[model samples]
Target: MFSYLVETGHTVEGAVKSLERKLADMKLQLLWKYDVTTKLFEQGIRLDQDYWILEVSHPDLTKKMLVQNQWSGFFLPCKMVVFSDRETGKTQVGILRPTSAFSHLEDPVLRDLASRLEEQLISVLNEIEQQQVV
Candidate 1:
C-alpha cells in the first residue's frame, strides 16, 4: 500500500495525460486506466479532485519477462496511480514498483529483469514529475 508519490501543480487529469503521452517516447504503452473518481461518483460519493490507476506495458519487455519466468505474469503490466487531494487540489503520481515482487525470488535473472523494469518505470515517473503544470 505504498506509492513513490510526487506532488505536482498539474491537474490530476493533466498529469495522467502527460504521463500517457510520455510513455510512447519511452517505448511503453498506456494499456488502460481505471477512473476511481468516476467510479466513486457512480457510487454517490463525491470527491474534490481525481484518482486513477494507469496500467503500462512494453511488448518486448513483457514478453521477455514471461520467457524469464511465467509466474512473473502477475507483475507484467505495471500499475501507476495519479491522484489529487480534496482540500489541497495538489496532484500526485506514483507507482507500485514491480521490482519489489521480482526481487523476492533468489533468481539472478529475474532480479535483473526487475531491476531493468524498475529503472525504466522510475524514469517515466521522474520525467513526468519534472513537467510544468499547464
Candidate 2:
C-alpha cells in the first residue's frame, strides 16, 4: 500500500467532510483519527488497497481547490503527503510511502497506480491550461 501525508491549516474535519463522498464514490474508505489532547487530526483515505493520508488544520480554500482540481501529480507512482499553506497559496506535496507500506503493492500495482494518476493529472492540467487560455 502506498501513502502520503497532506497538511492543511484548515479544519481537518471540514476537509474530511468534503472528501467523504468523493472517496466513497471512488470506492475508497476514509478513516479519521483525531487526538484532541494533542490537537492533531489525521484522516486516511483508502483506495484500491492503498492509503492516502491527509493531515490538515481548519478548511483551507486553496487546498480544497487543489483537491477539486484533481491533480494527478498529487497521486502518481507512490504515496505522498503535502503540507499546504493556504495563506501563501502555495502547495508542497511529496511522496512519503515507507518501505513497509509497499509490502502489499507489487510492480504491476505500482504501474497501474502511476498510470491512472498520470491520466488524471493530464486532464487537470489540460483544464487549467484551457482556463488560462480563456
Candidate 3:
C-alpha cells in the first residue's frame, strides 16, 4: 500500500499523545500539528470527526535528503495523521509510505533512506497500536 495505517485502542486525543511520545523516542520532532476538525469548524464547515495532521522530521535525516536531491525537500518533514475512523468510531494513525512517495525519483540512495525512515515510522505506529488508552 502507499500508506501504513493501524487502529489504536485509544481515543483521538490519547492516540495523539501516544504518538508524540513515540516520535520523541524515535528521535523525530513534531514540528507542527494541524487540527483539521477545528479548522473546518472555524470556516463554518462541520467535520464531526476529530482529525489531526502531524508534521514530523529528523533534522539530520532531512538535511541529508535535501543534500542528496534538492527536489526531495518537497517531501521533507513527513506527515502522519490521527483521526476518528468514521465507520468504526475508533482512532487510527497512519503515514504515507516514504518509499512509495519517493518512488518516482529513481535515486537508489534516496530510496534506501526512505525505506529506513519508513521502518522507523512503522515501528512508532505499531507501538501506538499496542498501547492501551490511559
Model 3, position 18: C-alpha lDDT score: 88
Q: How many residue pairs clash in each candidate?
A: 0, 12, 0
Estimate the TM-score for candidate 1. 0.88
Model 3: worst 10 consecutive residues (lDDT sum):
57-66
TM-score of each: 0.88, 0.32, 0.97
Across 43-119, the per-residue lDDT of candidate 1 in tens digits comes to 99986668999889878878888898888887768889899876777788888877776765566887787778778
lDDT of 1 at 114: 71
Candidate 3 colliding pairs, count: 0
Give Cα distance to truth, residue 97, candidate 3, Å: 0.6
Candidate 2 per-residue lDDT over residues 1-134, each given as its tens digit: 34433333334333334444433444333344333323333235322211224432112322333344444224322332333344553333333342333224444444444444434323322332233111
Best by lDDT: 3
Tell me how far the alpha carbon of residue 66 in candidate 2 is from the true structure, in angstroms, after superposition.
Answer: 29
| lDDT at position 132, candidate 2 | 19
Estimate the Cα RMSD of every predicted model relative to the unseen true structure. Answer: 2.0, 13.7, 0.8
Q: lDDT per model, in order?
A: 0.81, 0.35, 0.91
* Lowest lDDT 10-residue stretch of candidate 1: 1-10
